[model samples]
Target: MELKKEFTDLEKSAVKLTVTVSQKDVAAAYAETLGTYVKQAQIPGFRKGHVPANILERKFGEGIKADTVSDIIDKALNEIFENDAEKANRPLPYAEPVMEKMPELDVAKDLSFSLTYDVYPKVDVKNFSGITIKEPQVTIGDKEIDEELKAVQERNAVVIDKKDDEKVEKDNIVTINYAELDENGNEIAGTKREDFVFTAGTDGTFYRIDDDVIGMKKGETKTITKTYAKDDKNESLAGTTKKISVTVTAIKIRNLPALDDELAQDVSEKYKTLDDLKKDIVKNMESAKARRIVEIKNNDLLSQLVEKNPFDIPSSMLNAELENRWYSMAQQFQTTPEQLEKMFSSAKQTKADILKEWAGASEKMLKSRIIVDNLIRARNISVTPEDVETRYKEIADRGGMSVDEVKKHYEDAKAKEYLIDDTKEQKLYDELYKEVKTVKGDAMSFADLFKGESN
Candidate 1:
């Protein structure tokens, strides 16, 4: 079908597309639709295939005209969108074109309608190179090594049953049966659990009972009333006060392994001696610290770049980003969006409030992404076949899998495309890093560095 197209730019990265279909096209579409109905449509008091054209038209003329008009519009729009010459008028991937006006179906005359949609903003990145960024200089000290060694020892520790007279203390694993009680001290239905275990005095334990668990001997029963804060992690119990009855059934203590050659052997076969384990720990810590430093530098550089180059983002893209972030947060909390919304309802928090709190970070992330993508395109950054092979080898070595196996895992087209894109981004970052002047700043401890803090 032949079509005449006109484009109009609207505010906020929106565009209006007006398309007119010729009368000849509409007539052709109507005839094609009519022929199909005549050939297959059933009618009373007549042979199915022998229905008269006038009768069919009289019975279904309006329906045929509407379907034909819709078909013509769809065909014209598809042609305009798919044509390479019309790429400039295409909407952004996240934006769906909505019909602004629906013209009445008219087979005898030309048909025209307008569609409005958001498009990606044209970005021109400036001042992206030669910027000064601070790089954290981190070193693995003995204190870090000792802490890591202690963690390792703890991991290999054995759990031993506590003595009969022993009381629960910090780091002791206690198994208990618990139930929520009403004001009358009656156990609430469906609120009981048996063999619930947690370590005393640890954040992993329930906030209401973490401190209360301390000094409780085995077989002891206690009931306490606690009020949970509004921001409690347990959404169901948040901002509610309840009485909980707890009975400690068992207590166990962790016996940490001695920091010696025997412990090293138990930790890993690669380490035959304590010094070997320490050396490996130091190497791993240094590598992790180096990676963290590069990550911080990259984030800082991108943040600066985004700040220098600002543009209005499409609302659709921002909404998509926010949705992804919201879903991710809900997943972390083991809840659904509906459940989270309901939980917030009690606290008088609206969806707008949540969006307002997260919009700043989400917008920053999108700005950084757009800037990096534009820079990569401007510089013609690409990943070579050798880059893919090298990446495959690296992944294979890390996963203890064959290179062919790793390649097989990424045989899907999308996986390969993602790998290529990731490689290109890395190359772009490396080039930009060279252009930036980085100064070594104050040294950071392992704890601070791994915790994602920068000087």
Candidate 2:
């Protein structure tokens, strides 16, 4: 086949490709298509594979010509794209080539057409060194240690049935049957739960009615009306007013074990004494706080770097990032895209609304990734085979699998490449982290450190 090609650079990291095939190639492809039809031709009046050429053409002339045209175009494009030189000029992986215009198919003349698609943008990362970031100083006080100990005690507490006249109290366990009621006090369908267990005065209890349940005794039934805040975590119930009927089926009290070496032994065999447990808790808390500080610093560094050196992102890549975000959110809800759409419909929200909400964050994430990749290339950061082997060993020990088994899993899932990428990114971040100038800021309490930022 003979062909002529031209490339045109377009805006927003897009390219236009035009190709013209020689008339000789078109005629040859047409003749080849006709020969195949002749050998396989079957007609009513003739034996299979014995139909005359003129009769077959007369019967299926237009269809054969159309198929021939499609075959020729596919072959020509494949040949051009498969060439090493032309392959280098192809579109980005996530963007498909869209036909700009279709040429008229004719065997007597050369074929010409054009396509347009997005390509990877060129980025130059700069000013990544000597960046200043604030690192939070977190201090774990005695109060914090006491709080952690209390949590451990609560986890190990045993539940005992309440007396006949005992009422619900703070920190007591209660099991109840409840249902939501409409304005007219009618039970709403699909809004009822049987044997729901929760601790009084704790966060996340359905309806936040700890005060209302304080005086309710065992086997007592009561109905209460409450209005939830506009920004409630449960979007469906947010800004809504409804009555809920509750029947306390059971009331129980927690018997916390005395805080001592005995309690430490009950909590974990690794703890030899109460002091040992406290030391371990402090070490773990400090390590977690250090990690959080590093995360915040890295985020600040990236944001500053992006601000200093900005570039246009390929629209195709940004759109793909948004799609991945949506898919992940849907997975968390354990539903398909269509079902999620129906859910949003019930909540008076649309897919567009969700996408709009996530657009800014998605774009920022994509931009950060692109910048990091560029920096990795610029700095020549990479992962060695030794790094991969070490990672494999760590995974093997943690998962209780042999190194060879873990290696096989990574290879079978084609995850080794991703592991390499992750290793390279970490290495690059470490290198950048060393150049950062850390400034001492105000101290953050242990509670604030773990509370995290609000959405």
Candidate 3:
């Protein structure tokens, strides 16, 4: 169990650990390993478990040596890393310790091996305080409330099926099947869809082909070449023109309910009148606007902190983050990473190209993350029971749920831990804001500020 250890510094927060075991232990381990093989050996001209060590060596010496070396290294690493000591030197959870070189097992000499692994980079954040950030002022009033009300009314709209002979029209709900064609005007495999429904010019059919589907009656099909803008929201269709054959299957009219107190009551029991709904909408929108402002503040501060504090992100960390982004992009395209590769290949882009394009942003994200972690740890910021309770109450008040219900929703141990950690991080940032100067930037509306927010 006795060992000698040496730590050598490497680039990108990596450390080389050298572990040495005496010749006596190596000889003993070799003997023990040979004995295991001796018990199970079935060499010709020898009885089982009776094969001589020298003969076994001639047959399986290399295998025995490799196994002994692996066992020794595993034991050595376990004894060191399992001590819960030297938190800074610990390997990151996602990164495994890579051996610098595979050592040969020799009973005549001491066992010596080295490992290189990534740890968290030493974070010395600079200029994280006393920075001025622009705080956008967004107005949440009757206009915002009315927009939200309109959405709620839309959700409560009634859909009525039109006659079989009815033709698709603007603002009419239509169900259509569509497929993309290649240069030969043939339907490419895996491009066909059926039973797709959307409101023309409103909900937007597949690829926003509302205009192409209009004026077509049920069971009618037409092939049209549609060109998408360079900045189209759907990345797959952006800057590309494809032939789409759309067949309108059904048409319906959406009847929006009257915007009055009765409609408000039907939407939610908490709103007895239209005025009550408007008041609640205002309150919710204000809360959302405030949350969005805080997010903007945090992002601005983090961006500044990342620039002020420059450090190398461990390659493993950056690679992991880029991998996550790649998978996310694949998900956005509704395809697998393997397929995504082919798609990019067709465009003359390689995986390396995409990863190189994303590396800067990924590294910046990691740097900002490290800064947040270091600041919180240095400040000893944490969440108390009261903090969690207050958060639960706020959520319940906003969602029209009881405090008990909110608590029950987050009752899972992992969920509770996540809540606590999130609250703790927010608390650290809240204290950080005290040293920051917030200046009014520009007047914007709630919708513009929270454009992509789903909730």
- TM-score of every model versus the real structure: 0.81, 0.75, 0.88
What is the lDDT for 221 in model 3? 89
Best by the lDDT measure: 3
- Cα RMSD (Å) between model 3 and the true structure? 3.0
Model 1 lDDT per residue over 105-185, tens place: 777888899999987665778675557899877777889999999999988999999997899999898898887777789
Q: In every candidate, how many clashes are there?
A: 0, 0, 0
lDDT of each: 0.81, 0.80, 0.83
**Candidate 3, clashing residue pairs?**
none
Q: Which stretches of candidate 3 lie over 4 Å from their true place?
A: 44-47, 93-97, 189-198, 202-207, 228-239, 332-335, 340-357, 452-455
Model 1 error, position 368 (Å): 1.6
Q: Which residue pairs in model 2 clash with each other?
A: none
Deviation in angstroms for 84 in model 2? Answer: 7.6
Of 1 and 3, the candidate ahead on lDDT is 3
Ranking by TM-score: 3, 1, 2
- TM-score leader: 3
After the best TM-score superposition of candidate 2, give how far the Cα of residue 176 lies from its true spot, in angstroms: 7.5
Q: What lDDT score is found at residue 359 in candidate 1?
A: 85
